[model samples]
Target chain A: MHTRAKLALSLTAVSTVLGLMIGVQYRQTSATAALGLGYLRGTVDTHTLTELKNLKASNQAAEQELTQLNDELNQFERVSSGSDKAMTAFQQRLTDERILAGITAVEGPGISVTLSDGASNGSDVEQILTHDWNVRSVINELFTAGAEAVSINGYRVVATSGVFCSGPVVRVNNHRLGAPFTIEAIGDPETLKSALDIQGGILDVLRMQGLNVTVPQIKQKIVMSAYTGSLPGSPTYSLNEAIPSLSNNGT
Target chain B: MIWLPILGLLIGAAVGLVSNWTIPVEYSSYLSIAILAALDTVFGGIRANLEKTFDDVVFLTGFFTNIFVAALLAFIGVQLGVDLYLAAVVAFGVRLFQNIAVIRRLVVTQIRAKRRRRFNTTS
Candidate 1:
């Protein structure tokens, strides 16, 4: 009887500790859930998580440096071009070129298209998941329909931007992106929507392939952020050299 | 009398919930493995008591040692780029099931013996 009492007492002690830890673990998981990172629970590779944090920090630093350099350049240009008609005209042309180069944030009427993976119910897994080609084709159709500016997952689509598959994720402007892909295009909303919505078009093809493709959502005003990635530092072809040959042709 | 241990478990859980204390996310795996080890030890203790083999020193020491050794193995596994924690998980999981099975059979036999005693006296 004494031994029985002792056994019960010891078991109770051990159980208490177990219950406490289980409670703590439950609370910790829910805390992560509150941060929207609950899905990462056991699936998150700590190595990659740390790497992502470091990369984000460096990217932020680079953006700040770029902004500072741009401000200095703009101040110099404003001071030098003051009270000079030719210089002001040149400045205006430079601004227009910057807009076209996608280095400047643009805002106008356009459409936003969202594409996501379909249900993976005992079918071709490849057909259900969104791929790089799907994103590229959508952007191409939008541009052909008069989209002046386009962006995928907030990464501005510049002339040199490459879209390709990177394992399970899609790489846009060398940044890995996952679904749902939000492609924002600044253009005539009605025209862009109609172009993508045409019968047997790219959107229809994707829908047929068991992908979730949103009919282009027309917005009265949508803002596309500037491309922050590095660009070519030096140009091999100079516009100054081409001007001389143009003048000769005119003569 | 059996409810005593269960009440203690509820009290501990309540204290943990109210405290709002938690370890870092990275250490959660280690903690979970440790919890599994503790549970295995607790069930093993119950089975030992039912079988007349319960030892206070062994039960208490086993509870702490199991938790510590399991967590240590997991930490080392992380450093060695191995899943050694899985070994702990499998070992403890199997033992936990065995202990529970023994405890269930012992309880059922005890209940049967009591019923038989009552029938014999009434007859």
Candidate 2:
């Protein structure tokens, strides 16, 4: 009886260790699994389901709309190709400028930029969330300003890296990363940094916003993986492109 | 992805804040112990919660079949980089499918065994 009881306890302890190890591995990879059931429980209401269904219908409708849009774009392209000589040159020049400023899609080995800033001080623990937009917005801005690739701390922002504020900590890829955020981006550091410091850039905006934004150009060769721009035809965003309102603002 | 993390954060914050404020200096040793215990408990909860959704082994299906959908998604956003939310959504969906597939196989096997037993008895 004593031996049997001891074995049972040992099994329990072993099971606990196995369970915890499974949990750690799961946390390291499928962080969403931990977070998924919660989201399904929370936001997946009948109303939300209906909205999603409607959105799906709209997206299907958009296929037709997209064909029409493509037709229109083709027409415009043809028209422009025929008559807008100077416009073409100007557009080419703009592309050149984007490339020059390091905002163009690039493939090479270079620096990776990781950005992190937690709410330094809040009246309560509610404020310390490391995933502050005050920080991520800056980090995303770093990318837009031609960061070759940026990871928040160690979490690689591969399509699935969750970047959001949780309490006072910011979760990157569901990994709770801390401050003194290290960002490594692969590119010409000089041009990339300039994109941020350029008049009315992200750094300038960050400085105005009163959050610290630092750019450390490294001497070590930064290796950037090739062709990491959004899939072709995906929406292209310029740094601070929305500064000029999408439509008339006064109205 | 958003909800669990948010809930965890709120609860964690509550635990962290509550302990700091309520733990008295006279019981400082107890306070430290309590904090450690509370943290471990929450950590365990988070782990259990995750296992419900993601199976880490899915990444190793030999043919990448397990993570194929996720890889496709990652590929789609490779240009602008992958969207974190989309990755989470895809990963969760794939994992759910994996779990369901397991259950389906198990149920089918059980039904086949019962059928075989019935056949044997009838014969």
Candidate 3:
């Protein structure tokens, strides 16, 4: 072949190789970009899946802890309810005191008061909702009417239990409770019902504030759960033993 | 010679489009560097041909060597925890641009000379 033809053939071969490489490189780069995007999405999915797994593990651990605690309580109850007469008497008195102190769950014929937010028709929003004081007044009235035990929304009302408003919700024993508050009191059903429904009383006051109050005549079974919160420390006071002289009392 | 090269380019492109070949992601960086180096050589060949200093042996040798050296540099950079492929890209990119600029100027000057000759003949 002539030198010109040889050169032409060689140039053609080189251009062919160049073009092939460029095409392949273009396809490869695009594929790499796509692969990189998929990898990023996979990383996010992996992280979310790992977080969900961790939450499930923690929930399982908490359930196990609750079961262990329940087993311990059952064992204590079994031992306390043994066959010795004197032990039985002591156990009875202990249970009675626990019920009176709101430390034990009690169930009997009593009153169930359901308080709910009223309709807001151009009325103040606060007036429509039951507040902390409303719950406290109802509880006080029930106790004065010889209530044996009381609970608001399953939270047993004890001596140290506090009822206060935290934003739109009422907190009993530091647990947040929302309206349709079911206040259950174990007592003489007729007496408790009459005490709450008396003219110009707690029920009337609640009604005046535009709250929806429902007092069923007498629930056959009203259950009040034991208080689950720790009691606050009592206030310490120094003793004043000195007696006053009668001479100062004349003035 | 030019027509042969163009024909070869079309054939290569057709082959590339029809084939289902793929390179792995890990080697794509090296391939990209090699492509850049090859591009620089191809443009350099075109410039050499225009300047009447074109040599087939030199063009072929430079094409293979540039791709090899660029790919090797990228591999070494990966092992050394450095992005040495970026250096190859910059070098090849600058050379490619310079060659393109020279080619454009040459083509433009040739067109203007041809136009001037036509005008002289018409007048």
For lDDT, the strongest prediction is 1
Per-residue lDDT tens digits for candidate 2, residues A168-227, read 567765667667676666556776666655788765665454444565555356433222
Best-fitting candidate, scored by DockQ: 1
Candidate 2, which segments miss by more than 4 Å at Cα?
A1-53, A83-134, A137-163, A167-169, A172-180, A185-215, A218-251, B1-123
* Worst lDDT 10-window in candidate 3 chain B: B13-22
Candidate 1 lDDT, tens digit per residue, A109-190? 9999999999987999999999999999999998899888999988999888899999999999889999999999998899
TM-score for chain B of all predictions: 0.93, 0.33, 0.88
- Report the lDDT of model 3 for residue A66: 58
Candidate 3 has an fnat equal to 0.62
Worst 10 residues of 2 chain A by lDDT: A242-251
Q: Where does model 1 exceed 4 Å of error? A: A40-251
Candidate with the larger TM-score of 1 and 2? 1
Model 3 residue runs over 4 Å out of place are A1-7, A36-251, B1-3, B120-123
Candidates, DockQ: 0.54, 0.01, 0.38
Cα shift from native, residue B66, model 3 (Å): 1.1
Q: Is candidate 2 or candidate 3 better by DockQ?
A: 3
Candidate 3 chain A lowest-lDDT run of ten: A234-243
Estimate the TM-score of every prediction: 0.44, 0.28, 0.42
